[model samples]
Target: MDIQQQLINAGQYLKANQLAWGTSGNLSARLDDHHALITASGTYMANLKEDDFVTFNLQTGTYEGTRKASKETPFHTGIYRVRQDAKAILHSSPFYTTLFACSSETIISELFIETMYYLEDIAYVDYYHPGTQELGDAIAEKANEANIIMMKNHGVVVFDDSISEALMRIETLEMACRMILKAKECGIKLNLIPQEVVTSFLEDSKYKPRKKKGENFQR
Candidate 1:
């Protein structure tokens, strides 16, 4: 599929899964080393059209076409600039994930197999005003260390070599957050998988192969 259609499909899928709502999020795919296609400002992810996206210059922080790029363009470009493996990025405020982002709670990635893989190396960026260069710079500083970055009091940003993998990571994050909140609410003590076990699974398990940079894990 074309990049535009891929992003549209991702948007619709996110809407169907309740990972995104209304015009509160943005999605982008790297078009090349120097340019990206990002959802236009104020466009609803659930109903994105081809015209709803703008071609943004990653190096110049400029855009082509008529529509304005999403206000969060700085971070999108920043991630691409820092991480050459990043092909697609998804930024959204899902209920559970956003709740966790806004709270003082910490997430335990060793909770399960999926969490160990997807939530591994999550980075936190202290609260910065959305759309500001400071926020973008903060995210970029930690972009090389993680695939998922949580913006305190704002939302989460996930990126991977393919849009599908990016969506998978965000979905796993939301599920983990929901489980954590529910367990806390019920006063249930959750047993975490040991770090050694997690490391073993990541390194030796046959269930999933290690992900190499620039490999597309699109489903």
Candidate 2:
């Protein structure tokens, strides 16, 4: 509804958490069924405003707004195309997610319950040059399994209906990554929670939306 305000809030949160610096991160919120408002390319996260966001058509998938959408938009668009439930997407290069992102394997959390609840498992899509079809395809494949994904050697990407929830997911992911890094300092094996526990936790809390697909925006 209020896309600009949403951008402002997300930008502020990014600044407060140090998740982004200069013009490094981007965020987007669905404007209607067929359109989303995304941060324009090259906009600094520390001082972002509503006007800094641009509109992109969902079906045709083009930004018609005065300002250009983020260059990494294909990454965001790929997720949106695959996840009908996702209303907001956030892309950031936080220190730890970036650290784990560069790993050969996909990062999974055995450390935090929040990680289990927010993201059953984090997916890792191997490096593909940004804004490319290959990257989008790899990312979309992962989107089917999880909402939070670590782009190989890139950063982290998150999707959820509410921008607030998506932002929280990013925070949780960073915290878990930080803990893993800290524990590694002691040479102790990280005790990750079992898959059974994560499954049970998800069963305990489930959301059945009244409307799975909102009205698709049209030209």
Candidate 3:
């Protein structure tokens, strides 16, 4: 599918799954090294159209289209610039994910293999006013450390070489957060998988074919 359609579908999917509430989130994809396609400011993710997106130059912050880019556009562009392997980014304030973000809890448990692999070493960014250059700079500093970035008291920024991979990790992160909460409620103390086991999984050859290209590239 085309990049536009992929974004549209992603918005719809995120909305339907309750990952994006109100107009509190943004999504973007790199058009090239210098430009990106991002959702417009205040556009509802569930009701997106082609015109709801703006193509903006990363270097100059100039937008070609009539619509204004999302206020969080700087962070999106900043991430793409720093992380060349990042082809798409999904920034949303999901209930469970944001819940974990607000707390001191970390999403480092390896309750599932998918969580261990997809969300390896989730990074944290301290709270900064939304849409500010400070937040953008914070993201840039942490972009190279992990694929999923948890903005303290805000939301999360997830990126990957493809929209599919990015979305997969987004869903997985949310689900993992929910599971963590549920386990706590049930009085089940969660134990992270052993470090040795995690190391082995990381070095496992079975997942080589399924892994996306540029999955390990850092800024």
What's the distance in Å from true for residue 102, model 1?
0.8
lDDT score for residue 56 of model 1: 93
Clashes of 3: 0
Q: List the residue pairs that clash in candidate 2.
A: 33-217, 34-217, 110-192, 110-193
Model 1 stretches with alpha carbons more than 4 Å out: 212-219
- RMSD to native for every prediction? 3.6, 4.9, 2.4
Clashing pairs in 1: none
Q: After superposition, how far is residue 154 of candidate 2 from its true place, in Å?
A: 0.5
| Root-mean-square deviation of Cα positions for candidate 2 versus the true structure, in angstroms | 4.9
lDDT of 2 by residue, 27-142 (tens): 88877778888899999887887679888887786898688888888877877877888889988899887888877634556566676667555667778987787887788777
Q: Give the per-residue lDDT digits (tens) of candidate 1, residues 25-107.
A: 99999999899999999999899998999999999999999999999999998999988889999999999999989998998
Which residue segments of model 2 deviate by more than 4 Å? 205-219
Candidate models: Cα lDDT each? 0.91, 0.77, 0.87
Q: Could you arrange the candidates by lDDT from highest to lowest?
A: 1, 3, 2
List ranges where model 3 is wrong by over 4 Å.
208-219
Evaluate residue 17 in candidate 1 and report its C-alpha lDDT on the 0 to 100 scale: 96
| lDDT of candidate model 1 versus the reference | 0.91
- How far is 188's C-alpha from truth in model 1 (Å)? 1.7
